[model samples]
Target: MNKPFLRPESGRLCAARAAFSRRAARVVQFGIAAACVALPLAAFAPAAHAERADNDKPLNIEADNMTYDDLKQVNIFTGHVVATKGTIIIKADRVEVTQDPQGYQYATGTSDGGNLSYFRQKRDGLDEYIEGNAVRIDYDGKQDLTTLTTRAVVRRLVGLTTIQDEVHGSVITYDGQKDFYTAKAGPDVAGPGNPTGRVRAMLAPRNGGAAPLTGAPATLTPSTKMQGTQQP
Candidate 1:
């Protein structure tokens, strides 16, 4: 068999092409791995008002002291810690946050001294917010669940001041992803005659027609609008 002689320039060109192909393959593999990690982290992000896209905004934290444990990959914030991401905000004396290998995040907040921990998030498509306070609060980023315990009180506020709805109990659980909550009474309410106690809810009417407690007509005493319309 006769072998054909190859040009040196041709040989060098063939080697360059082979090197380029290998680099391109490695780049493609790296991109695939990056996307896999990104997708899970995006799915596990915490949402405010059932909107996941809004939750993807940057998260900023302020604290007097912070510590991170490499072994557990946990972050601890102490002494007047405040964290905010988009329209969601949390305040606590101490907060511990951990993320699992799967990119799921868990946050726990505890009160120091007599101050209660707080959490607040703006409602979706509405000029309102949901705020709560308790001795301790836990938030699961993966599940979008928030738990408040020990004198837990949650309220829906209108325009930063007016209370549209309220829930009071010893334990309260809220599903931010679903915009729903459950409240239950605990030992603090289980005193004296009220053995099993009760959870209290003060919810406003969606139609704005009746008083929440009395179910009576939502008429203002000495109706200002009526008085203004009357002929002088």
Candidate 2:
């Protein structure tokens, strides 16, 4: 398999199409609706098998709004733009969740009834459940996390500005929200003439985290995941 690209200089990601941060996030997408359901553990084996390699595309979901309500009938949250199940954990800005006559539920504004997925798992090593904007998760509800699809990316909190992406299909995972990260591409610097798949530093790495460098640096790893991964 081909080695992956690391966060190169601005010019490099534009050329190699690897810098997810700088690239236009026209993500690959599917939809999830408003509902909460759970899947069992057996469904994870195949998904695990799919993750045995690192060279596939990712799962994407787009939405304008998402909400989860209980049977009681109350609003949760609104104004979310997009949610992704990429090489990281589930992310959504405008997210609302609640419970109803049935149980915990989730809803989005996409189709007035968007794509939604539900599953039970141990979150952050604690017993909990997850509702999505549309995903089906299967888990043993145990020590390890079990995702049910080949398209899902697992994310783990590495640090305040770092989250590791352990993708099933890509040799390269992103160390988002930072200028400096360790790419499997090895330690190197990016520059003109030498680009693409080369792990290089940002020629002009903007300090997105310039507040105070509150915490320590987060490390990236191959097993950085969501269901089976640890939270910071």
Candidate 3:
């Protein structure tokens, strides 16, 4: 998903972009706690909080300047790569992801931390980013899931509950398409450890992904011709 994780049919933004927008704000919030909110992108819970709760994780993605369909068909790059399905996500720093000769798709996440300190991932949400220092990630072809956790931190910059030193867990799950995710709070954690607040959510499936104020698509098309005098 986009850093913001909000996808528009205009295709200007992708899911990963949406994730970035929501979570990237946290890095900024640590300095200033102004009027900011977490925007959950995946299919995670706590209906209300989940609406804008972001996953706390950092990631470095490298796509082959290709479209979703291209990523699906051509295994283009020569280094580690990643991709996502309905609810599944992948990680591979120096790997390649393309259609296998057998018509099967493959991707790999390498174990390298050059400038990479931690990597965060939410099933399909943008707000939350699963962050950890040293990490070894593995992808199982079984359930189509990506797991990463190790003395990791799950932060939520949502509402009055801006968590910086609260819940700590060693595992997180992300599903790309299903748009659902769940965070497991570590044992010795505190402060809003459990997202149980009830507030009106701005974005939801029913709201068509937090649609614009237009409420509906506009039908105004401006003409740019001065030929009204002699045009057939």
Candidate 4:
């Protein structure tokens, strides 16, 4: 009987091939896990369409008291301030506004004590609106961006009552031009409900229908004229 002979190099080659196969299998498993994690986020990544005409409108502010600094070109409003520009509305205990040389406006709204500042804007040609609450709110007219800082909660509403989607974070930045928003997590938003201070979002299905949301709803109405003193 002929003795079976196996080359030493052949056994080494077989072992190397087995190791590569195991690594490739693990890589495929990791890819599948990553895709599972990304699918839910991608479903809600559609861009919003905000009102384009609001950019051309003027800023109108109402407050209990107003002070204007001519040299600095700034207007400070205090005591229940409400500012409106086209379909956009901002409410806070204090608001500071400044206009640039090119006629673009910037505003910073802050709440007193433990109160939260409010912001709302209508969507373009739709019955929907975007609203948010935070400790501080900033609006940039030139870039059409809104930033909410510290315990921020933003929501998408249908017909001023039904909430379609909601997001919570320590800070949220909304870009009206791009119709998208981003949220960041921080310790400021950590609490009993969210101890880890992670960004949370609740998105509704896009079934071309509005569902009734449970809870008392608030309404926002835009002012046609300025309620505070306008400094030239």
Q: By lDDT, who's the top model here? A: 4
lDDT of 4: 0.79
The global Cα lDDT (0 to 1) of model 2 is 0.28
Query: What lDDT tens digits, residue by residue, belong to model 2 across residues 1-232?
Result: 9999876568765667665644444331110111001111221211111121111223344545434455656444334434333232333334333334444233222212344332211123222222222233332111123333312223322233332221121112221112111222311222343232222211111333222225453332221221222335
lDDT of each: 0.69, 0.28, 0.36, 0.79
TM-score-superior candidate, 1 or 3: 1
Please, what are the lDDT tens digits per residue for candidate 1 over residues 148-212? 88878787776676666766678888777777777776765454543444455555665552233
Q: State the lDDT of candidate 4 residue by residue for 175-194, as single tens digits.
A: 78777777776888777755
Q: Which residues of candidate 1, in runs, are more than 4 Å off?
A: 1-48, 189-197, 209-232
Candidate 3: worst-modelled 10 consecutive residues by lDDT: 193-202
> Could you give the candidate ranking by TM-score, starting with the highest?
4, 1, 3, 2
TM-scores of the candidates are 0.64, 0.21, 0.29, 0.72
- Report lDDT (Cα) of residue 140, candidate 1: 79
Best candidate according to TM-score? 4
Q: How close to the true structure is residue 82 of candidate 3, measured as C-alpha lDDT?
A: 51
Give candidate 1's TM-score: 0.64
Which RMSD values do the candidates have, in order?
21.3, 20.7, 23.4, 16.1
Candidate 4 lands at a TM-score of 0.72
In model 2, what is the error at residue 107, expressed in angstroms? 5.9
Tell me the deviation in Å of residue 83 in model 1: 0.7
How far out, in Å, is residue 85 in model 1?
A: 1.4
